[model samples]
Target chain A: MSGFSRFTPLVNALPSTIPFVGPEAIERQRDVRVKARIGANESGFGPAPSVLEAIGRTAGETWMYNDPENFELREALALHHGVSRDNIAIGGGIDGLLGEIVRLVVEPGTPVVTSLGGYPTFNYHVNGHGGRLVTVPYVDDREDLEGLLEAARREDAPLVYFANPDNPMGSWWDAESIVAFARALPDRSLLILDEAYCETAPAGSTPSMDALIGQPNVLRMRTFSKAYGLAGARVGYAIGTIGNAQAFDKIRNHFGMARISTAAALAALRDQEYLRDVVGRIAAARERVAAIATENGLRPLPSATNFVAIDCGRDGTHARAIVDGLMEHGVFIRMPGAAPLNRCIRVSVGPEAEMDLFAQALPKVLSAVR
Target chain B: MSGFSRFTPLVNALPSTIPFVGPEAIERQRDVRVKARIGANESGFGPAPSVLEAIGRTAGETWMYNDPENFELREALALHHGVSRDNIAIGGGIDGLLGEIVRLVVEPGTPVVTSLGGYPTFNYHVNGHGGRLVTVPYVDDREDLEGLLEAARREDAPLVYFANPDNPMGSWWDAESIVAFARALPDRSLLILDEAYCETAPAGSTPSMDALIGQPNVLRMRTFSKAYGLAGARVGYAIGTIGNAQAFDKIRNHFGMARISTAAALAALRDQEYLRDVVGRIAAARERVAAIATENGLRPLPSATNFVAIDCGRDGTHARAIVDGLMEHGVFIRMPGAAPLNRCIRVSVGPEAEMDLFAQALPKVLSAVR
Candidate 1:
């Protein structure tokens, strides 16, 4: 395919690899409609009724560009976290914010640290910018903090990414340990402490904004995509020092945010009661998913996230077969990309109807795969 | 204000600046509410009722991430343009796509060419990536295409941006001229043919998709923000070669698009009758704005866009005064930023209620400013 041949060498060398194949893509490719929709870690319970109402109320204003400063959302986020508005910066989602942070810090051949099977999207951004990856493998299904810090120091990496209440594995580190990890990193190494799943994590798993607000090298990412049930809204924010927050203004697409999405996020933030309710429901669903996995003769990893990782008691291929088999049954789930973690299949929490579909399909899938 | 001290040298040297101050920011800073929001060239007429219905239908699905491939939207856009799906690349908006294209081609010190008073957001993106801009001044109140081609050739610039039915000035080149210019550019020089206002432009002002589709170096950007009245939806697409379209996959935030925004765009595209109706409304509003300018003894430049630029017959200071003066009456409008062009104040097309507000407020604001 012919293209503009003068793209920067970094771009020319990069592959067109997506971080994840969405369920919609699967439906099209396989000609099978997804019945359960339990993949991709989205809340099938959906956004709060109030957020939907807010979207409806604001739909008529769709002709105006969203506020480029994202001032209102930032102010709300700051108030919620008990920080100044200057301490917050908003973006389309954590994925978009990650790209901005990577652009701000990483250059060609710069070393970036992350868990081997960590968030693929971060790695995708780093690689897109020609940042060399120095990955530390997960230790016992959890992001190995000590190993990550060691790698950062050894590589003199300018950027390190850590996810508490991680994706894929659904493992988490407590707030104290996470704080120590951030503090241990060199001041020269900026830490992208991704707390995308924080709302669904155990109480102690996420550090308070105050704990890292003063650390210029630390940027804590939070999103409405998880516990708030607005993943499609694509709203996320980063909490850092005022200077760090302002750094995004240096390059972010000021008018890139969708106005209704901003309204949805603002509404989602105001209704903390809804958030709490959803978090409880997510926890219950995770238990149901775990129970289903165990009954299917699989081991469910302890998860403080909105999903459960089931160890199929076999190798990567076995886990892959289970994932594929379940999708054939219209129960779409995913597995880790790399090994060790790939030996487990990841299942996102959904309503009982979807969970019932999973419950009904798991035994058939396992038997077929076996 | 402290931040990580080791951001990339380019990032370190960059100033934190926004391309445009949104009306909301103006409202906050000036302690006034914008009663007539025509400043940003957003569609004040709002999106079609059908689009609002689509948004409402999909609001619950805001819990899922938008398709990473943007499959359905791309397919719809391709069909609309009579191009293949591979020829279309989706983004948050034209502003977002500009940033991506700049990142793909521009590195530190790479030369870029554009009109001196061209889109500030494009300049912001180029500057953010450390591209040196070579600007050609507009001739006769329109972008001087010949001058732009000359500068691009002289600088060996890899990127050139030209907007037809332009913003701020609302001027345009004929479709023949635009097509010839694209075909004339060196293969190494990528032409960003920004047709953001194409839907509002007169027939034959926009080049046919087939006119430039096969060219690897040309990317024509279009948005649903103008005539479709979905600026807040943040949907835009680039038409180019298959390879050019796929190049975005290397670095774009694949999941960055909001789900409801995509739904809005798809619904809006399917309802071409609404689009035709709105375009006619916009044309009528533009004529009304021009009449208002004439009544106020200002020369209204002919516009093929949703906004009109009126010559204030003075200097930048006078135009600035008019912009600020309108704000005092709760009528928000804008002006071109650079000299020559800055002698004109820009007004956007809106519903008659807002037009009446502008019409009523213009004389008093002008008198006060005088």
Candidate 2:
């Protein structure tokens, strides 16, 4: 059967393509069992045991909708960051929040500036809202903040995206550079300073919450999916000025949060000891992945995130082959979607056992691709 | 600090109003402890023990992202309904799906039809998308199907919303009439036949899935939130043609679902025995609520849902007083937003204890209002 004929012109023009193909889809399409699940930058190290306990305890309360205002979670996030609750807006994840933010600003033909392949999901939202994307290439594998600012100015764009401690390359700019970029951007250009990987970033890499919290044009995005090890819980928040925070109230799915996910996030936040220990383990896993890549004659990029992007010493085709070959051996990993960046393969840190699987498979896959 | 000044005109024009006030918000605002939560139509009888067990088992797996395609859940639902997997599109919940559908069909000034005092969340999405709403008032406390059809045709509205076994009034139309309404609608008007309360509805009241599955102009919204007792899990789906289902991919947050919630839903679907038991409990609780209303000299509306709407034999203000009075007694019951319907108070079914609390509290609350 056909779809309804009356979908808006923008929706009709939008492609049906998804932002990212999940590892599960790959498993089905390739008919391969994913033995090592470290492809999506999700923490295979897992959430705290206390978080699991909270989910179990809250299991019976699954019938009640989460507070539409997300008061408790926002309050917890506020206290954790020393901001007012009004400064935070909770969402399903950074992906969901990006969609809402895009809808708020992007009209048909509006230019939205971002690094060429920063995050496909953000780009997906811009396109979904009929915004024209003005791309800036990565400089030294980090998001080109200066280029993004210039593009925003050139186009008088309302939206510009920069992911500090960037994905698909595991690159970052220090806190000072980031703050300067935020201050340099035109007030008309709303900056999405995505810090999804901030937790795993080096100490001086992320700016203090106070550094840009009062900035009207900047919103910092954070998620529990990465270092918090609760990707499946789908909890993410945006921190900015109170006005920017409540702007989400204008369009967000207010009751979109899952009760169990919220409970898990609260538990995850309360157990900072678990978080500290997990950060350490993620550091170790990164080293382990880098070592495996180095032994396979690949150069591992300096990373401030949970994943390592290894330069395959070849073109995109070769990198693709290695990625496909590794998946054949059940070592599922991802790479950058666009070229220059696609010459590298990205591997996420997981439990030691997954590292072992990747370690075992990489040598053979690299040789086969070579 | 203020928000970015360049939000679209539509966004600036939109109000930041939420659709529903959560019980938590009420408790905070009213400074009262809620001992009975029979206000939001949540199943206080809770999800099956088996669903809880599934959540516990899946807790450790929360670190992994749910399958972005939601292939497993879709396949399960397809099997359950004897439909093609392509017929189903999963979402965070019906609320989330409504937002996506509105984005697809409604643009600025686009006419969208719905019942007056219908699902506020649906209206919320329409307003968020800048769609102009043309609402048809209820006839005899039931949604006026003919009125909605006339409005859709007259306004050339691309979107029309109807909930079967409806909310606020707990009224329903027969399967034949609903099918006829769908068939009679213009092809340009996409009907959102919400079946959130379908499971609790009488068997003949719900049309077979085959009845309208082939209609491109019709989409059925179903939820595990109501009878299946997974409101907090935020699992809902839209059943339509393959084309309509795939349309969601153009704009949805592909990774929005919570992994544990998906697991819980799969477990809930598998435990149909538990579902049958809960349906019976809901029916009995409906009776319990009706009796409480009758004993208090209020008239209970005939219900095809998990809640009963009781007419207080007065105006909206009097009903509002009784509702507020019930809250003071720690019984959280809600009333309709508009007049006529607002003359009735809606009470959701829960466990016997909650019913007992309501039974005991109703007389005092009613007399106090009097």
Candidate 3:
């Protein structure tokens, strides 16, 4: 049946495209099992066992809505970062928070600056809101800080998105460069510094929370979906000035956090020891993936995040063939959407068994695709 | 530190107000415990044991992102409702879905129609998107449907919201009138038929799925949060035409659903026997609440929902006093926000122990408030 005749023109103009195609969809479409499941940057090593216990214990309480204030989780995040709880705003994930941030700043024809192929979800949000995207392509697989700044100034764009320890390419800028970028943006422009993979980033790669804490124009995004290994839990938060965080209250699904997910996040936060250990495993898995890539004649890019982007030394179509070919062998991985970066395939870290499946499948796919 | 200086005029104009303050926030601010836990329309009786079991089973899989497509859940919902899978769109909850719907239809100063003091979350979403609300006050505690239709026509409103088994008052209209209302709306105006409480409503209170399925302008919302007893799970779906459902893909946080919540919802849907039992219990508890109100010399409104709204026989201030008084006794009942309707205190059905606590505390609190 046809839709309602009068959705706003902005909504009508948007393509019915999704940011990511999940492994479940892949499996259904291809009628093949995804044995490796090392895609989408999910932690196949899974959340800490303690988190599972918390979920089970809290399951019976699933009839209660989560606190709209998100007091406990925000408090825990505050104590962990040595900041005030008022600085944090919880959301479905960085993706959800990005939508709110876009809505808050972007009006129809407003320019929004970001790397050309950084995160499709962020782009999706900007497009959804009728913001004109001013793309700055990557410089050496790292987000082009200077180019983004130039576009913001040129368009007088009120919003700009920058992801440190970037997705797709799995590259990052040093702390100094990132802080400099935030400081460089015009005071009128809001900088959304997406730090979804920050917990896994090398020490010098992530800026200290205190470094940008008081910057009114900057909001740092973090997520449990990464190093915390709770992607399916859908818990992510934005850390910024209290006023910036409070702005989220003006337009958010206030009672939207899933109750058990909140409990799971609380338990996960309390278990810092687990997070530290998982980071070590992720680092090891990154190295393992790099080694596997190198052994199979692909060059794995240096990464500051949980995943590695392997250069296939060809164009988007060749990378697409490798992605499809690997999926045929029950290994699910993704590739960059645009040129240059699309010469690569991205694989997330997981348990050894899944990695082994990828290790076995990659060589065969490469050979067949050739 | 302050927020960014360049938010859109609309965002800058908005007050940072949450639609509903959580009971947890009340406990924190008032230094009281929620003994009865009967506010927020949440099922105090909790989710089915089988749903809890599903959560436990899915805990280990929380490392993976839920299928962005929400394919399985949509398929199950379609099978349950006798609609095609494309007819369903899943979200964090009905609250989240409302936000998306508002985003699609409302622009700055766009007139949207709804009952006065209806679901505040829906109104919250409308205002967030810069839509001007034209609220038609309830007539005799039920939504004035004819008034809403008139307002829709007069304002040429592109969007209107009405809930079946209405919140705050727990009042409802019969199915034929509702279907007629849907059919009579101008094609330019979209109808959001929020049926979040339908599971607890009487058989004829809701229009049959087939009755309005073909109407392009109508979208019916349902939740696992109510009689399915999974409020904290944050699972809700909108049923509409294929094109309408596809529109959600243009802008939704594609990977937003919590993996375990999806599992819990799937299990909840499969366990019809459990849902039937819970509906029976909810009805009995509704009766119990009415009896409690009668015994206290207050009037209880007729309800088609899990909660009963008791007329405290005074103004909003008196109702507020009763709510605050009951909280001092560890009872967490709530009242409507505006005038007239605010004369009532809303109490949700719960286990007998909680009802007994309410039964014990109400008289003393009412006396004190008086």
Candidate 4:
């Protein structure tokens, strides 16, 4: 446990832990292989064939450093979103971007606001920067916009996190309500509007690109990880005003991007036809997941993302037992960590073979846990 | 210039800037095409064919996130370096790891030490974390180890960076000297022994992996970007004690690695035959570059790296003109930033075609600049 004695007090205070243990780690830790890898919200359907081809073509170019400005990718993203290229700042992924944004805004003991059990990675970053977390509990299993606003006002927090089509619970707010929340928040409290799951949301549930682009205090996070099926590519971007985007230049690892990842994202963006088809497939898989949960006498909550949360009609222990038992059968799935939300076990959508394994395993897990 | 009004005071005071202008940016800014891309110290010979094949095979798995633990890759690297997996920490590149280290050790006004004309990206990260820089002047065009040791003691610096077979000047100290310097430093001053160019250094130059492995405060950084010729893959690692490696988990983006990039690194590491071959090519190219510079009446410094630094017989302004003049002919090269070092124009070793372009253009460009 010995470490460099000179680490800043803030880093010293933080725990060495991953926000989420990947399925690969689970396999190693449990001494069992995960056959059905429908756990990490990755697109088991995979990226467009064109994206793979793009990666293949770019392999020779891997000897060269990627363009530090990320100019070409930003240009393509801007055109896709109808924003100026200056409004886009790319990073390794939303997780990496969250770290940078926290560094820019949070100092020791600074107040930051988020849902009590929201994305743990963001919370990790805030805690790493020595920020005091002002948590607003999720209301009825959805991120409570009103509660968040109240906490931000009361604490006068400088940073607020709100994710549309949220993870873990897979709930969302309408485009109008999200826009209202962003507009009504105090301008001094910069908002990180995480739309990482917005691509899989029901139509009109996510705001248009133009909705918050002009708001200097609101930075929207989007990724090619989920709907684009390039999770391993590590490509995500933040959309904001030019000034906010430029601010990333002050602290970001300017040449940190992987060349093939950028090419994969660009190709994925260009192949919108494949994205539309895959999104439909994702929607169908979500339905299949919910149907399986219902058949097992569990209540599957409505989901706007590529996953479903099934209520086990008990407390966290029962949910935990079900999760552990399912993993015993190589049917990997996750559950929420905090109360009320932890009453449900979360399963991400995947190919039907994996769904069949989950369906076959869930009944036995439920009975054994009971 | 509208931005989030609540950025930390340090962020508000810092200017948004890229540490280095990439060749792509220079091409765009100068409104010319880069036909001979020999700048940035990237290897133009490219990675091994086996590495490319690994990337092709790994393309299908891009849907899944890379293992957050980075277990398989870590095991491979540990075996390669004759260390335990706990002794290594992987990052996006050396650039990204530098940022994380700065964050861990630096707070506002924390004095950090490095050579005055050293890597700009390291300086950028230190400043980003609000660490005040204490630069030791290079003695006889080499990083002054005694001066750096003195500065660390005087400033009580928590961090100090020393690169072997250095960039911008291609200078180095013998391994025994470097080891002695490390052992003599205050244990409180963490040493970042950057050996990014070590793979190409002459025999007996680089200290063995075990030399300082037991030292808690010394972390040695190595990259596949240089001699392995995988600059765009963004794979770098730090070799240190178990404590220092695990400390990265307290804050690093756990899933930030691109799957294909890891595959490439693993494959490239396995192909040491190719590495030996390319190192030979790099040496020959360096000779060619030095010869071209000498023939043009410039003084080419002795280099143990994949690049040569040629003194242009004047100050920085004269060297800058030679660099710009070469760019006009699409022969892209760079120059050091600080005075004394700025009298040299740095040129990376490349394929003969690029060297041919540099050889063909250097004389004409020099005449024009003169």
DockQ (C-alpha based) per candidate is 0.90, 0.89, 0.88, 0.86
- TM per candidate comes to 0.99, 0.99, 0.99, 0.99
Candidate 3 local lDDT, residue B266: 96
lDDT of 3 by residue, A1-370 (tens): 6998989988888887777888999899989998888878988888889998898788888889999999999999999998999999999888889988998898889999999888999988888888998999999988999999999899888999999989889999999999998998899889999999988888899899999999999999999998888999999999999999999999989888998889999999999999999999999999999999999998999998999999999999999999999999999999899888999999998889988999888889888989
Residue by residue across B289-335, what tens digits does model 4's lDDT show? 98898888889999999999999989999999999999999999999
For candidate 4, the iRMS in Å is: 1.0
Error of 3 at B304 (Å): 0.9
DockQ-derived CAPRI band for the predicted complex in model 1: high
Q: Report the TM-score of candidate 4, chain A only.
A: 0.99
Pull out the clashing pairs in model 1.
Answer: none
Q: Tens-digit lDDT track for model 1 on B1-370? A: 9988989899999987778999999899989999999888888878888998999899888999999899999999888889999999999889999999999999999999999889999999999999999999999999999999999999999999999988779999889999999999999899999999988888999989889999999999999988888899899999999999999988889899999999999999999998899889999999999999999999999999999999999999989988998999899999999989999999998999999999999999889988
* Cα lDDT, model 3, residue A367: 86
The lDDT for every candidate, in the order shown, is: 0.92, 0.93, 0.91, 0.92
Q: Which parts of model 1 have CA positions greater than 4 angstroms off?
A: none
Model 3 TM = 0.99
lDDT of 4 by residue, A1-370 (tens): 3667898887878887768999888899899999998888899999999999999999999999999999999999999999999999999889989988998899989999999788988998898888999988988899999999998889889999999989889999999999999999999899999989888998999889889889988999999999999999999999999989998999999999999999999999999999999999999999999999999999999999888999999999999999899999999998988888999999999999999999999999988987
Where model 2 places Cα greater than 4 Å from the true spot, the runs are: none
- What are the chain A TM-scores for all the models, listed individually? 0.99, 0.99, 0.99, 0.99
